[model samples]
Target: MEYFGPNGDMYLATKKLKRIAIVLKPQESPAEFEIHFKRPDADEIMIKTEKDAELPHNAAIFHSAKTLVESVRVNDNPKKKRLVEDYTHINDQISTNETAIQDTLAYVNLTADIDKAGTTEHLNQIKELTVSINKEKRRRDSVLAAMIAHDWVGKREELDDLLQSDIQIQTPSTSHEQLMAMYDKLKQKGDQVAVLQSKLQNQLSWVSAEDTSRDDTFQELEKLADQLKDELDVLSVLENQRQSVCVGFLRSNKGVHKMLVELL
Candidate 1:
């Protein structure tokens, strides 16, 4: 064996060995030792070493290539084995659940754009998918909760409650079909208002730019007034529809405010 100090400098002296005793030699300056077999037929090996040249306590000991082979009894505790197997199974299940959660989240993100521009049928599918995703998230949390409870005895109840809380998020009272129908109508009315406003602006520009007759000017003013009236009527209906959509969502869940604003 080669010796090393705490600073990792190698010592000049070295020794070669095969098998070593399980027990360490008792302390002695310039220590003398012998390696021997208990059997009468086996030979003994003698070792002489100086204490000053001892390796550091943390240094690793390596055996020679020709070391004697020995059999050792292994621990076979049934309870410990079962516990290890159970822990492995639980970890595998947790890994599977995590993968499922990742897949569900990916689907949710993928459908986000679709949710914005989807037809009523597609939107309905998205709504169902979201509901299913939430349920899967809850299930994942429950499994994690169970694992936490198994590991921590005193905080089981607290962890369980945190994971499986009774809080329920409300959904819009308006049915998907009704809400989409209203949205379509509101969009049509908004387009009409835009058209009327544009027409009124053109009429105003014409009246100001042209040197028209007084009767013609009066006729242009009347047409402007009619356009304004039509725009206002459409706007009033649009506002009512917007209010209905907003109230429908606000009454259900404040969390949906951003979504409603984006949709509008």
Candidate 2:
């Protein structure tokens, strides 16, 4: 069983298109995660550039994608040219490794079947093929990790742009239907308070300092009435702002979608 991380699909892309590649540099000892992004869709031009070595391994992919976005934003032609060249070279290596891996796996499977049939003829070949498979898999993984990193970075930029946009946030409001519902509630509370007042008046003859419990109950009922009045006031203000606030919210929502599509 092969375990793929969040960036797993990147590795799988190798078999489909010549869009991925990598090169080993034991001497240079690059970061744990380095990725290159090409325009996956042909309508857009693929941009490439050198990755920042200072970026932390966990953030390498996203940061690289930011750099690409910046390049597009600023139209940095010289940097864009360098990145295009690098992208091509890396993809070439990925394509080569992908082919090599596919071929080795096929041979390995063939040899394994033959060995199972009690043929000692392909034993050495199987061992060599297994080693080759491991090597090719590592190379493929590196390439895919890079692609996944680019995806993260691109998405982050889009989100950031949306958040930073100057969309005046309007407070939410109660609709006419909502206000009508609340008005009904307020009316019910008012009726309850009126009933409580009438009961207190009827029981006034029984009131005394030794038993002020009935008076206290009437006071509590009065407070509840005041609370219902306050709620009604707030609902009235919200109802007034409902149309404008809702329109503002809709505009802001559309703006977010527009900004995100621009990133793509």
Candidate 3:
């Protein structure tokens, strides 16, 4: 008879009790046994035996093999535990990254509607959020590359799906036309203010030079200077208002541009 060891090594036994007992002896034996047994083929025969007869030798060999097998099983347990922990960590990271991306997209969408109503502070906030979004995208990409390298087949599919489903924010184009329009309006207001200022200065200079020589001329010049001063004040106010509008337009445009560049 032949039995397989835990390590897959095979040992032979004979029907003759002496040979069967001798072959099962432990390695540290002194005296040995030799027994003969009939072979499966009628014409053939063989003899085998172990060297030691200290105890039930076959039982000892069987138990030794069992111990080796058990040791291997024990060794694999920790490896399995580590694999589970690693998988859980990867899953959590992916979930967090996906949520961050979604939130960033939402913020981008909300900011898209900000036109004349968007304050400089609001635009600044959007810029900050976009910066965070880009950082998260980089992190997510790094995780995806790692997953691919590790052959994480299930995670690869899930990440691919998330990327595909992600909302892409388009970059806003530079508003050349809008800027030009605001510039034109401001230039016109500035020209009006300059004209009014010049007229006031000319009238005041006339009054100062003619005050002693001609009372009537000096009085007329004073009245003209006062009227010009009033027009200058009005024009200054209009210019300031136009400048404020221009500032708002520029700020909104900057925010839009920043959002676009991040998307690209």
Candidate 4:
């Protein structure tokens, strides 16, 4: 399961398009959280620089869209880039060796807590990790009691000394080679993101050769419609007159087929 810390951050983009919000539970799919950032009466002037060069018509809207896409994408900032690399490395290690290092890591984390317990950040971590340490201690006592064929409480001090020694011996050795391997993966991911961003910016920057005039096109269409309506009206009247004249000729006394042709 994924989790978020209590910290919530947000940014405003003057040069951007649409924003949306989704459930704040699983996805960071844009939602409002409580404000940690109240505007103070400080003298620091924040000038806008993400604005694009003045372009014509729809280009301005496209520029805003470009800004929006870039703004939403993280890992572009140097600090965030480093943080992402560290997160990836940590998760990979934990997932791979979770079973193998459970007891040793528990012991190590407990000792680390002892050293860092003064800080508020470390204090929270220590509280949670202490549960793992207790579990390890209970497991150790059980196994030792079985092996010794007696109550583990009898030599509690000696048993703890031995356990500590074992945990120390099995401590993690994050060698240089392992670091380089992780770095290679991070580099590959960074390169892929760069390529994708380039493609997006290029696609968004496209402009038309000439400005289209919708008003002119609509006016022309209206003119043609009126002309067609007039022609249709004239055709309707002529057909009605022809029908009346044929009916009059049909009842002729002069055997009036020829008279009809020369009719008054």
**What value does the lDDT take at residue 123 in candidate 2?**
48
Model 3 earns a TM-score of 0.24
CA lDDT for candidate 2: 0.40
Residue 241 CA displacement from its true place in model 1, Å:
3.2
The lDDT values for all models are 0.42, 0.40, 0.41, 0.39
Candidates sorted by lDDT, best first: 1, 3, 2, 4
Q: Report the lDDT tens digits of candidate 3 across residue range 139-232.
A: 5334323322232334545533433454253323433234335435544654654554455455444433312334455445445445544554
Candidate 2 vs 3: which has more TM-score:
3
Model 2: number of clashes?
5
lDDT of 1: 0.42
Q: State the lDDT of candidate 4 residue by residue for 180-243, as single tens digits.
A: 4544554555455455555545544443213233334333333433443444455445434433
RMSD of each: 37.2, 40.8, 42.7, 43.2
Error of 2 at 262 (Å): 22
Window of ten residues with lowest summed lDDT in model 4: 45-54
Rank candidates, TM-score, best first.
1, 3, 4, 2
Of candidate 1, the 10-residue stretch with the lowest lDDT total is 60-69
TM-score per candidate, in order?
Answer: 0.30, 0.20, 0.24, 0.21
Q: Give the CA lDDT, 0 to 100, for residue 108 in model 4.
A: 60
Best by TM-score: 1
Regions of model 1 farther than 4 Å from truth: 1-173, 209-212, 254-264
Clashes of 4: 0
- Selected candidate, larger lDDT, 1 vs 3: 1
lDDT of 1 by residue, 55-154 (tens): 3210111111001001111123454334334434544554565566566566666886666553445545656666665665444334333322333356
